[model samples]
Target: MELYKAAMVLGGVGDALGYRNSRWERCPSGVAILSELKALGGLEGITVSADEWPVSDNTVMHIVTAETLVSDIWSLTDLYREMVKAYVEIVEQIHKRQPDPATIEGCSQLKPDNYLLGWHTPFNKKGSGFGAATKAMCVGMRYWQPEKLDNLVEVSIECGRMTHNHPTGFLGSLCTALFASYAVQRKPVVEWGREMLKVLNAAETYCRKTIRHMAEYQESWFYFETKWQSYLEERGIAQEGQNTPKFPKIYNAEERDQVYREWSSEGVGGRRGHDAPMIAYDALLSVDNNWTELCNHAMFHGGLGGATGSIAGCLYGLLFGMVDVPKGLYLNLEFREKLEELAAKLHKAANEGEAV
Candidate 1:
């Protein structure tokens, strides 16, 4: 398995398993979820069939972004138009998949004429959900070059703000994309959070100078930075093996939820934009190259399982490729072929430069 293909495929796999027809995602207890997985034969015994373990809107919207990026839209204006059109089209499938409310609201307000007029969706203060982050992987894949850091930051903000106009909302998109780029570069997992903070400074510069109504969200713009800093601080404490607590081995439903919420700066685990990416980052850092532990840390945490799982799975897959992954995870995954195809195209685009 190629690196890019593994990344995208595992992303879908994570979304599927974490979702499990919304059974595991909605289940508040990690212990209970693990028990259920045991009954169903665990990761090796379970197949990621669409009928049983179908992916939610997390993977669906991700593919939408990947498809639009690969299309023959070279310029930013044209790219935004194509992306908006593709996002609008996904509304047809929203009923089948449980979508984020921010996604639905933002996509509903998009119009073809708006993109043509050099405008995106209106400012959405309440749009600080993880929906935009879910589809940001390909943006990183497309511009995953050191020289293209400016392009990556700019384009990520544009795509993120297309729907989530608030800084907190769109910055989650930026973090997801930026981390994917870092993964492709094979940067150390421990360095990712710190590196992301440095990149956040760059992102803040861009937002302050470029966004038309930056002042509206300026107050909350640092929300993301604060959250990342907190995560890094906690990580540092854990690395030192100090009195800082480690992730608990067992918990009831409410206890599990409370622990994760406490882990989140946003007080909601992976439910919001700030916490989802952070949770995924934490998952990537916690696992010592163990795929199943990766699954446990990323998904079964009584949060937005699909979103965090996809983000973490994609990063882990990109970093390690498919050598260590269980075969059953991808053997029956939905749209496996299509994911590989897109991965190849995205890899080519990232390496050889985007199509002109």
Candidate 2:
């Protein structure tokens, strides 16, 4: 129960800190971000409050997903319906959250019953953003039963496709949820990404069977799978800690851009679905037991700091809970109490085999 609370609450804390009222989120330079942190007395001096460090759209959409999951939904249709309704409400608050373009477009095209008819937002090359994955931690929490891996993939991919139809987009959704489920099962963090690749085979088969008619579906999965495999290889090499190259504690803008470019769709770094989660995973794996350093690497990168920090925080919180999180990091976080309530409910629902 406490672990769930940590995941949700720290996710907000990460968003707030990395967002820094949206000042650092788009800065694209880890060096500059570190310098600014030093000026503010570094991480310890920070407080996560709305007026100071408000959670970004990442946490906002995550809340929407969490609320929908805890509703009394009897079937997938009901789940998707509730999601559409919630998204419609969120769209009205655009002036506040600054949602991604794909989200806005997808919500605009949604019909209350469209999902029931097996319809989703059409594929757009540019629609493969990280928004889908960033908001899916609850999807992982909701269907966390390890034996329900297929169910997790089905719902997660469909949820991703509601706004982002590309393989990178939906696959990232599956990856995030899968990792959360593994965390609930107490799986080793080092093996999570590789395990995800094994599951990707099943997910790819499912996608091929369901969306074969879509253009280039096979190529899409191939691209997504290859990228993940490559990342896993890099992680494995790093784990050996032999005479191989090492990643820096804080990357300069150029080095950060290069790393993200390799993972990006075009060159947008953390905005892409795949790279966003990859960045979070990289941050988690690079650290031994340094939570602050993990967060520093997670948030100071040249990518979408809020998205990566939120993902990293969710992963860490799930595995370690709030016990090891810095004291007072979330004391002033906006909606902290509400997030903890939702997390408790979500955790209870997961254990009870029904939404409560």
Q: Choose the strongest candidate by TM-score.
A: 1
Model 1 TM-score, 2 decimals? 0.92
Please estimate how well model 2 matches the true structure, expressed as its whole-model Cα lDDT.
0.77
For model 1, residues 22-58, the per-residue Cα lDDT tens digits are 8877776777887888887878788678898888898
| Best candidate (score: lDDT) | 1
Regions more than 4 Å wrong, model 2: 113-115, 209-213, 237-257
Deviation (Å) of 74 in candidate 2? 0.9
**Clashes per candidate (backbone, < 3 Å):** 0, 0
Q: After superposition, how far is residue 13 of candidate 2 from its true place, in Å?
A: 1.1
Each model's TM-score?
0.92, 0.91
Candidate 1: residue 286 lDDT (0-100):
68
**Cα-based lDDT for every prediction:** 0.80, 0.77
Query: For residues 1-356, what per-residue lDDT tens digits would candidate 2 score against the true structure?
Result: 98899999988888787778878876877778888889987778776678988888888888888898888888877888888888877876754655667777767766775555433566766567888888888888888887777778888887787777778778888888988888888876677777788888788777777754356555566777777778777655423332232565656555766787678777656787788888888777777446787777777766688888888888888888875565667988888988999999888888886532
Task: Judge candidate 1 at residue 42 and give its lDDT.
Answer: 78
